[model samples]
Target: MDDDLRERVEREAEKHALLNAVKHESDADVGAVMGPLMGDNPEFREHADAVPGLIGGVIGRVNDLEYDEKRARLEELAPEELAEIEAEDEADEHDLPDLPRADDHDEIRMRCAPNPNGPWHVGHARMPAVIGTYKQRYDGWFCVRFDDTDPETKRPDLEAYDAILEDLDYLGFEPDATFKASDRLDIYYDHARKLIDMGGAYTCSCSGEEFSELKNSGEACPHRDKDAETVLSEFEDMIGGVYDSGEMVLRIKTDIEHKNPALRDWVAFRMIDTPHPREEAEEYRCWPMLDFQSAIDDHIIGITHIIRGIDLQDSAKRQGFLYDYFGWEYPEVVHWGHVQIDAYDVKMSTSTLSELIEDGELDGWDDPRAPTLKSLRRRGIRGEAIVDAMIGLGTSTSDVDLAMSTIYANNRELIDEETDRRFLVRDGNEVPLGGSPPDEANPQLHPNHEDRGVRKIPVGDAVLLESDDLPQREERVWLKGLGCFQYTRDTLQYTGEDIEVVREGDVDVVHWAPARESVPVRMRTMEGDVTGRAEPGVAELATDEMVQFVRVGFARIDHVPSGVADDSSDDELVVYYAHP
Candidate 1:
């Protein structure tokens, strides 16, 4: 039994070592290598005394194999190939920005609190990467708190709560804890009472227009001078449903004569009758405002750092009073300016996007035209690329207005190596060949990665070409991977098989698909959908599989023809173009 147990552990250890070697491209540490073995093979734990020696032996053998393979590959590679690999390694070291240092004794804690009013857009997606990076850097805890207090203006949608979580997960960020502001109403109520008892807040029954006039003139409302006992009574009445919506509000006592009008006795809590999607609305009539709720939550939740946009600077200022009133230290606030990619030319607000979707202006939040995170994911943009682009911009205060090319360039570098190449000709026009073509044309799946193998596309006498690719005059053109041809009217005269020959001349290199073997293609770009024809192999791609359409750009398969169980090569292939 002991011998059998030892042999099984040894075999598992060896298998793990080889997997680690391939993953890390080198020998993994014995401690790191043991993690998987112990978790996967409980029998190894039972025979723990023999595990260390077994792990060491397996790691040693794997290291030897890795060294031999690396050495042989180095000998086969050209000098430029070696230099390029070294350069890529160096570039990776500086990909993400260096986080600012924090106090060592402070328990690092970060929160991504988003309002669950609408689906997350590209702008909202930025927070997860930024907050996730800080958490990773400080080895801190991350919390996803839904700020669903405002039901009148920005109404919370129940579906958006799950959608937001899905977006965060897709972006490689998983929260250590999840919370909803509505669930913590009792806590907010307790804090509100504390503020009232401390004489830092009071109840105001002034009408909106009357309060606006007083606030603009830096004059206090008549209710501001009420004693704590009086204010507490009114607050109880407000919470007890005695006050109608907008009839009364709880105002934090800030300097009425303060220069900033917004800072002049801001409303801390307000009466709203609208029922919360996830809560009993009638039970809680007075809801804490955004800044007030955020301040209380931040301190109670032990948030050490707050990363947000610079536009919310006033929020920090307003929350400062509450922090000071309670004698609590505020979290270190890091602010970044807006990131505008003008090429998208769409409104970045979730409310606006929601309206558009409601009005049938957009298909849905995942429509290729929309800049929602789901749309980006559907369009084949990797979450890592989004992180890279955002981190590359760093946490600067200056607003950045860049072209879509900036993001596309960052994304292209990430997907270039992994994406398989396929042919797609838009509005395909038949090109008749003068002579018989080769039986098959094999193109490398990736131009730089030979190990990816080749895709064999059958070649026939007639091929479908993009109508735009055909020149008005007779000229040589290279049909990629097949052969070169010269077009005269409708007939393409055979030139030569050498691509170099066509390259040396004024020939246009174009991609083509076998006329009969081509599948119907519809590519959804940011502008609109473009109808075309793709190689038959494209239909074999699984949903969400990203591929490059030779001169067209990268795209992810959105849908294949319905009921085609195995491969839908003969059916319509729908894809969402990510970027060029």
Candidate 2:
């Protein structure tokens, strides 16, 4: 026997002998009588020598068995008992977040203002997860603030906004309240006036390139010498659209020659001609720039913690200047490194991905390949799995690009059990003489997963198998958890290309079917045309039911119109969403 097998056999034998010896111990004294004969006997002596090590090994094996038997015993248990066990097990495995130790000094209460210029991407996803996590653990509020200050780059209307909310919602995330920068124009304007009255801000009518050059050369602009009153008048004129677009901007009166040019008189507000989505055109013209608007809003909204990406690390400095300028309280900021995926070897960008979605180069934001929340769902990613993934990474500032497959596989492990199992026949062909599916075919559900007790699958004389398996058939094949089979094929029909049909030689074949009429559907994959088949009617499965087709992997129901549920016509049908 191989070393591993031999070790296992010897281990088992030792375990059996120890138990027998222990039971018979009551029959005699060990040192005076039992030890002498047992020590002399070859088998007894061997077992005695190995018993302790084998006992240790047996305990380890028992632990392994219990771990894999998560949902197994439910197959034969009462529903109530099964539920109790499953719930208890879930509670036992529930992971608690590692909350920061509350030092009296560690305070956070803030809004997460994301520019809705594009759909939420990977880095954007992580920020909210971390923010929501901190908000929950620290008793701080996190609001989804639409940073709509810059209309030049913002997408008009609610398309991107709606999608962002949908993605966050799907991931079990929510904010305490929703706010938009556009709603706080008056607030920002008031702050601008405060800075002007304090002689800390001035309006400059420099061209873009002039300001760019000034910023680069660290040279003071001649326009910087104007008094606060004259600067205030120009600021009012700019807001009143007295100045043409991009003609002049209200800039903080910081040292123009400061070593860090970004700290040197950054523009606090600028002119914009476009209409704000949340405000009427007549309501505003000059917009508060990012740092200026964020600092004021953060103080006003009582935001104490600001979690953001490391790319914006300098933002902390600019924001600090704004807070200092206005003498406003600043929030504690946490910046984590951005996430990149190796498959693409670049950062994920919402704007780039949105263009792909708009140009028809990609499906909707939820396309399986897109990496958006919807895409992850379609790919059978589990919420718990995502939580696990994020938790394992922890909060760090080091840059990293983990493999997409690693996260997918991590979530897949959690998803496989929660979902039911089905069989999928890619390029379908039927098997003959399927030992008649029992009149009432009910396979023991998961032997241990009582919550998912016995499942009843339709069995018939002839069952379908995947086309790929037809030509590769040999003498025997196993039908998953079912029995084994032998098979042979007749001259199966084949299309000119590659599709084929085959006879069931002698094998128990298993595959999914509508058991009646299947709902015609298309599935997406990297190579495309993964499997297109009609699914079972919606009435048979629970709305939230997740299932893996035996050979084809996992799938969920898409929200759509079907005869089984809504009365809408086929053409009017919307896919009712489901996931594995």
Candidate 3:
């Protein structure tokens, strides 16, 4: 290869390696480095014999450079410029699916209606991510509506309402409008009256068991054919509190022998005397069923598009009756299958989660074991990671059962570059040094970015090493960047400053912290709390700052040094482990 061509190939290869390493937060593979270089410069392939050597040289050079430097350089570019680059990169991946008939609309409107019975879980994130993307694509409005009408079975909690909103905000969705179903009780009541006057609905006074038997047998209830005048009168009686709970229910008129049993005359409203957490106590005795309230709200709020799970298709059919009665067009509907992550094993239902919390089986909704969004956030899982994973799934109708690794992989891509690195020694064993220890050891804040500066940890004659990393037999080991050491039992005898000597010995390299300068660390892992010791600098980290605990995994600092001198800084630092 000519000198000029060789230089160009080398430069391109270096850029490719740097970008890849920065993105993945790990060493770039030879194939990953060469693929982009070869694609960008086809001429390089002509000299295939020299290509491997050139790529290897470039990779070595790139490895010498710190990741934070590349990240800082990338951040120097304008926001729009960065976005364009990301757009091009994402297009190359072709991960996001195209919206169905996205170009045909002048305006698009979408909503995510979540019942505020409990905090949102990871599954709940799919709707906002999917709907938010469509809203962005078509430059339309996005809304969040709390469907909290049920007070008996799925009662609403004030904390749950706030938590759901907080999760949405963390996911980067700002709703153009917000609605609470309880606040629209008057509107639902008016719609029920309209259905009754139009002879499309009637009040039924059948016992619970009697109605269930009749519906199961495809037989109409005795009151199903009541005239509008009498039905209206009975509905008035229900509103007047003359009917006890489960004794009276307003049913929407549908096919008595509909092919699907669930589609047969569905109940629209029921009498519930339970007090709502937010609304007045027992002020409204009649509560509209979810389908009834949602249908009315969707129409009244002028929702143009409805994207939801395929399981709710029956709900659409039920709501269709009301739409027909009021002479209103049903919004365009699209359904996708459930996105199930069976690796969690834990149930994601709000009612079940509430029970678990009540029984003290969980620390709280934000516990690392729970799949709630608050828990994910506490563990340092970014909203962008959730968005990427959801969008990658697209709108497939088939049910998807994914492993936890699916999300962890997505999260690693986004966090690896940004999260700082720190050393942690769990269940530490004292390793006494033979030679004099240096006063301080400086390690780069990030391996790939030297320009980001170093973190200085005070050194001593003894260092804390993870119990697992203790040498079982005499062997040469590298004590990270500080120097080489000869390990024998609990002794880490200083040998030389050259890391190459330890690397050549074919021994394991382990991370350690100076015994005197280290601070206690308690990480809340998915399994349980793991106590350890981390470098003193770890205690200085700001709340919510994500950091990789060297061999331990990534974690988010949950507690930091408080301003008051309460000795909290001396206490074990608390963190929530994100993932390995």
Candidate 4:
């Protein structure tokens, strides 16, 4: 192939390779890049057989760059195409369908009852995000009720209550009111008494094993036939600590021959010797089951609609028995399937996460590796991004897998423009500079905006470049806004500020920070810690400010000690890597 033809084909190959890598958030495939290359340059067909060989080295080098570098380079080469991709992705989140029978109620109300075992994860976002959006739509009241009555199993963490409120606030799912079932035991007991008097419930002393056998056989326990007065007396005894844990239970009266064995007179309340977590509720020995307490609380709170998982359809049915017994109408219930967000590497279950925390596998609920909302927040994720991504999943009845990329795309829109561009070279190598480059240069903080005026970048002394970005001996390269330079005779010699030279040279552009303007940086990512040096301006920004590192993705400055400019503190700049 002629030199001119070879150059054109290789440039096209590099652009397509970068585009492919951006799509998958990884290296490009030869098979994929080839198709786009030929389509864009139909004249290359005559050389098709030699095309692969010609573009092989180009594709390999493009793949050799980091995801952020590929993305950044693509931004420069194909700004229009890249912006179109962003516009296309920004619209992927669907607006939720209107609520059914929205006008039938005088007022719309909803409740999210979470068991306070651990911090909320990504899966937990659906309930609050969806409800919060609905709440705003209807001007309805959203309530948060903590299911913390289970003291023995799923013990409530005292800190979790506040943490949940914080998480809710972070997600913009602020609740109109919050309640804990632990604090409402007396109310649950009052309802228990009324049910006994109404002959809708009875105290059963049969052991769990004995009752399971009877329930499965479609036979009532011996205590099932007790009169309301007798039932009330036994219920009071059970509440007054007359029975040990598992010695007795308050069973709602249902059909003895119910088709589903689990619905056959399910236990409403039980004796638990373990004290409650809250100081005010510590005196109680009898605790209500989730279904029983949540049902009663939902009605009392005047929840007009209930949103829950399809797995809890049985619980809704079980609660229906009690609703019917009290001659009360059941709230409108919306059941959705479980959500699967495979993008996050951590386990979704609170129980599992709590165990991991206990075993010292994680630092805490806010560990970057954890899927908790707090962790995402610490990692520079905006709540708007989470809500947008979650709402896009929709409340369908089939298990759905959510791509984290959707969230990243959503977050990029919110943070990319606001954040100033910075540079952080991982495993930094000091590259000698022997150029006519200025001592410092001013560049736009964001590519799309020139008015932000974040700061000017220092460009003197030595440059710290990622080892891979270092040009080989005698190789020419663009210095990104500085100028074109050639690494020859042991130095990166100035080749004048000429864009044509860079294009004609067909050399890779690399980002760098002057050693004088850069400070030691340690970025914490899910994979591991990467040590490097970033622009000192990054440390100057307030902690938690999201900064886009040129060719290095975005990161949130988690820690910036006081007097960093004077080296008065020992703490180094610590940032948490958010996404590519």
- Could you say which candidate leads in lDDT? 4
Error of 2 at 324 (Å): 1.9
Model 1 stretches astray by more than 4 angstroms: 1-101, 279-283, 472-474, 495-497, 562-571
lDDT of 1 by residue, 1-580 (tens): 2456557776767666655554457775675566566656644432332356556876786677755564444435333545555676667565455555576436688899999988798877678888888788778888999998988798998899999999998888899999999888778889999999989999998999999999998888999989999999998888787889999899999899988888888998999997777755546778989999999999989988888889999899999999999999888888889988666656988998998999999999999889888898899888777776777677788897656566676677677667888998898898777766677878768654568888888776778988777756577777777776878878887766665454233455678888777778878989998988777788788998999887677899988885332234455678999986
* Worst 10 contiguous positions by lDDT, candidate 2: 494-503
- Residues 1-580, model 4: lDDT tens digits: 4568778888888889888888778888876676556546766643443566667798889888988898899999898888877775776443777677879899899998888887788889889999999898888998999999899898898888998889999997779898988888889999999998888998898988999999999988999989999888888888788889999899998998989998999999899998887889888888999999989998899998998999999999999998998888899888888888876666788988898899998888888888889888999999999999888888889998888878877887677656777778888888778867777756557643556764577887678878888888988877665767889877888878565544443666677777766777778887767877876677778888888887677889898876554433255688999986
Query: Candidate 3 has what TM-score?
Result: 0.83
Computed on alpha carbons, the lDDT of every model, listed in order, comes to: 0.78, 0.58, 0.78, 0.82
Best by TM-score: 3
Q: List the residue pairs that clash in candidate 4.
A: none
lDDT of 2 by residue, 16-134 (tens): 33323332322122222222232233333212222233344443443343322422422232345455545655573423333333354456565768888766765566666666666
RMSD of each: 13.2, 12.5, 8.4, 9.2
| Candidate 1 minimal-lDDT segment of 10 residues | 42-51
lDDT of 1: 0.78
Off by over 4 Å in 2: 1-102, 105-107, 279-283, 342-347, 378-380, 434-444, 450-461, 471-474, 480-482, 489-521, 532-539, 559-580
Q: What are the per-residue Cα lDDT tens digits for candidate 3 across 400-478? A: 8656666776787677666777888887888788866567878668654557888888878789988777776577766
Stretches of candidate 4 above 4 Å error?
A: 1-94, 562-570
